[model samples]
Target chain A: MDKRILVIEDEEIIAEYYKKILQNAGYEVAIFYNGNDALQYYRQFHCPVVVTDLEMPQMSGEEVIGNIKEIDDDQVIVVVTSYYDPATIINIMKKNVYDYIVKPIEPVEFGATIKRAFESAEYRKMKKALEQERILKLERQIEWFNWHESIIQRNYDRVDRELFSNLHESFNQGAGFGSLLTLIRLIASMAKKSNGNYVIDEQMFELIKKNADVAEKILNIFSELVIIMNRTFEFEKVSVMELHSLLRMIIAEIEKYAGIKKMKIALSEQKPPYKSAYVNIESDYIKKAFHEIFMNALKFSKPSTAVMVFVDMKTEGVEILIINTPEIIREGVVGIPVEYENLLFEPFFRIAKVVYEEFETSDYGLGLTLVEKIVRKHGGSISIANILDSSDISRASETKVCVRVWLPLASEASRGERKGA
Target chain B: MDFKKAAESMQLPLDDYLSLVQKFLERLPQYREGIFSAKNSGDMKRLAAEAHKLKGVALNLRFEELAECAKKIEIIAKGEAQIADDVFGMLEHLIMEIKQLMLAKENRDG
Candidate 1:
């Protein structure tokens, strides 16, 4: 009984044609002879379905629809128009109406259309009700968490402090040497099992053990940096570090997070003589900067795509390119508009077309902004660009977006060493 | 055209259906006047709009001949069909036929 249909038609007889059939079907029906009255009635009564003729006096059907959608984005409207061309019809379909009927419709077809509109409206109402309920529950949970956040934070901080301190002490004392060696031996045996043709000779085992030691030392260096970063914010010391090793370590850590989504991280091999280039950077700040940039590449890319990191040296500085395919943007889902290219680096700015429900707990649109700030602090520049090609039609969906970073080369350290020599 | 059958199919009474026909007959003169003024001023957009409305209304009332004439005029005025000077004359002829039928029906019923 609550279900109602509003019919808006300029022609009185055609309006009556709809009214007679709809009213006989045991549904409440209201007739408006013009779009203005229809819109006013819609604002007042909010009918579940609207059957409107496309042409009317004082207001066209398109204008009425646009205005009504402004009021209620989910309103279901069925357009009935006698006049249309191929182009006009295509444009009308893109307006996102419920359905459309040409002139000279029979009673049966009209009745079926009404029935479908009613069913769709009911379904939408049910979904909206459920969504509202879920939102209410989440709000309550968030409120409770906010109330107890201080205590939760204090306990988490205590656990982190104790864990990293013990971790730093173990590395300093070389306490895990025996366990590390045993783990390396286990890996070598597993490799031998996987490849039955390979011989389990002592010489090969020695080589594996040597490689494992190098890995452990690199890991210990990373652990030390994490410990110092946690303890203080000041950049205490600047040292020359291998750029590729730093990048490789950060990529390995980030790969663990991407593993949940089956994503891949790839680093292009640095060509010949420049394979192991060094940069003089504060250990903590450089690690933080790389972590922030790499994690963003992981977060924004589709789960199936690979994130690529390419490094090379330029006359001006060391250039790093982080490239990945962004989530495919469809018609309704909000995407980053080209006009917002520069604005994306502004603090707290987020793309309008992002599906908020999909990324409900993502960073407060501050990841890119933070990366930009840190890059600028380190005398570096970062720019974002859409990678597209007009020549390849097949690669349209794989449009790669690249974030490029250029950091000033640490020439001072190299110059000081040369002078000492 | 069968007014009784049209009304029955619509689930409407014969009296209500005849009243709709009478209302359409009453508005014919104003529609003709508007179409003439639009044509005189070379307002094809206005002519197309008027003719499109007429076409829909005529079909609903089972004025088949009038509806066909209005449909032609509508397409021509909207520049969808080739413009022929005879279309206006054809619409006028159909309007006269409808007026004659309405007068005859009213006389017989009265």
Candidate 2:
């Protein structure tokens, strides 16, 4: 095709000079003295190659080029400037030029430069089409990721809440296992990532559990989850303060949900003295296990009652007790730990009938089994006993079921007085 | 006692423990001060960040004893945990130990 070209130069010599070169190169050429004239011609001809001087009286090359582009984006143009300034360069870039030349020009270089410009314009168009395709591909991936994130997040939120009240009702006698709750809160958040992976890796656990303070909490969290996963486990030692702060962050993150569910939790002492307590376990496992337990408890229990969890001092160490009125234990799961029966901590082992009925939605019978395993790993025992019997005079069944978890699971403690594990 | 002097007196590496001690001492004035000054600041989010940072440094250094003290300050800073006279007492003990360590080092070096 005989490409149409426009020459816009303020100097007579440069204008005539461009017309000669483009004409020699087999282009149909038009020449003009000012930006206004070129633009006027441009609007009429819609020439693709409009070579123009940057400095002009009637209108600047930049303004002319901008208008040309707004009119037709595919138009290719070259700018000629006398002196190059940073602003001019930026302005040129913004104006979207094919190529630009400084004065005291070389004819051959200018031709080659213009040729390169045309090639690049073609290249850029191709690249733009390519980039758009890439974005669409990325959009698909993003859409998929967002879908998974939402599902995981929803489950994460729901499970964390369930753990809170359920743990309170089961272990705490209305109030005190603040530190234990802090630890449980963290594990609950981790456990809620339904689509993600959590493992009870021993080495990572050993390193994490070097600190004495948070070891028990970590152990408790991981132990619970490990049982849920039905796997071998190790306890880790990360700071309880970090864990608790994480909890606070999670609480703050899901502040809306807690408010919605009217779920609330308070530390036994408000400000527990032990921030750097040890959680002798893997974080992910503990979090998952504890969250599952709480979720079931909350779902299965009667709402509107404060599920209280508190830590009390025991002669052996600390006792983190999750006291809840189970009011219902279906005979079978926690039944005398019979044949392989030692496997109550297995995934989906709901000892209490209330659990199955309540958490019928996620029929995964592995929450309490996990809690049992988690408690055992901490070298502690969890007993699901009755507190208030169903006072039906004829039936005379226990009304309140107390799942008193005599956890070494005691709450936060003072420095240097750690109970021997 | 000055921490630097304590390390020097005890023949402990002055620079070795100074940074850790320096980090701890940075918050001494905070524990002594007893209250965060951003009274109108809606919450202690920033303070919590600061406290979180202190905890990492405190625990990593294996300054278990000192770390315990910093944890208290962190709680108070968190607004959920309050600072008490005992927290100051712990901070004071850490400062005194570092100072004594420095003094012991200085005496040995001298």
Candidate 3:
């Protein structure tokens, strides 16, 4: 299409003169005798080139130039004027006008300037088209990557399940040894009760019954452990999570244990009208991570101490800090050692055995290990440390352990990205 | 009032040049009112701009004497020259000549 040129001049004859020359050059030309009409014309039709006088009634040509730029900064404009002020010319040039023409304009020179302006307009259009093409190519590449990632994730999950199955089988085979020993003990008690006799006494019968019950409980514990150990995680269903609700769900899972120790779970107040702190994560995996962390905090907290949980909304993410002081480090010990922080998330890693012995608990499970795995899978992080207040250090009994988790926020754009992932 | 000469310079027929001259005459009253208003209000910038516009129109229409007068007035009103009264008088005289030309054509046409 022939490029459109807009001419703005309040002097009727000069405007007509420009219109005639531009029309004769086989260019589409529109003329306005005032700045108002010229600006209106540009707004509606978006002329590629403009020839404007510096001074006009209603609105000045400079204002017209500025307003046109606001609509579309790529417009090519040439300022034509009889005004011989150098300052005024320099000022208009600063506005990025394409060319300046002094009146009475030589027709050849004016036409040449218009041709150059058209070349600039064509360049801008071509550059914009190339930029749009690049964006489309990038979007296509992202789509392909997302598809490839999903396939890889699917295979990884299959391999993970198979590996867990093998591990569980080995564990079950190891538990058979414990089962055999219990049987031998029961058999020994039975043989003694049957010493030269055909019937068992009441006390002997009670002994046999008690041993059977212990065996049953041991088997149940092993089966439950296998179930938890063999659990698999998938990040396919990422969504905006209501962190408060998720946290409450985790707390509820361990509420019975908390009650046994008389440990109150105090949730720090969330900001505002209780709107959910939405985090971008796989909902189930993140929930499982929080549940494990909460369990660990409850298990180690001193009896009757509240497990303090604070959920704060940060600019980049949601920060959840779970703190328990006077926690069980090891039997007589109260605080976790600094070196243990790094090893806390290793699979099957546990605190000192003396802690379990003192508490009379058999399990020091992979809670933190699983929590770290799930957090890292969601592109977030978890940390554990011992924070000592002045009073905590002064008093030998105080041990403050903090478990901090940072989960990135689920912004609208991130949600779109997550869908692709 | 050499209408044929003016038309020849513009490469137009005499009737076309007369039409343009008539249009210029029709706007003369408004131009006169604007010049007087600017002078009475001491608005030198407006006066200069108005005179500059008149200069452009006169030059395009082949009115050489009037264009020269308007250019002088424009220079004076813009404070580039110190001949405001003399330039104003010349501008008025040139405007009267155009008005007389318009009257002569109207009488001849009638």
All candidates' chain B TM-scores are 0.88, 0.50, 0.90
- What is the interface RMSD, in angstroms, for predicted model 2? 34.3
Worst 10 residues of 3 chain A by lDDT: A389-398
lDDT of 2 by residue, A115-188 (tens): 65544443333234334544654778777568656665666665455445444443432112443464455555
The order of the candidates by DockQ, greatest first, is 1, 3, 2
Model 1 CA deviation exceeding 4 Å by range: A141-421, B9-11, B80-85
**Tens digit of per-residue lDDT, candidate 3, span A261-321:** 7886766544563364355566766776777677667777788877777776778777777
**If you assessed candidate 3 against the hidden native complex, which CAPRI class would it receive?**
incorrect
Order by lDDT, highest first: 3, 1, 2
Give the per-residue Cα lDDT of candidate 1 at A218.
Answer: 47
List, residue by residue over A135-212, the lDDT tens digit for candidate 1.
654778777557546555656565455445434443333223444565567756665653557555676567657645
Ranking by TM-score: 1, 3, 2
TM-score of 3: 0.43
| Candidate 2 structure, TM-score to reference | 0.27
**After best superposition, candidate 2 residue B45: deviation in angstroms?**
48
Error of 1 at B70 (Å): 1.1
Candidates, DockQ: 0.40, 0.01, 0.14
Scored against the true structure, residue A253 in model 3 reaches a CA lDDT of 72
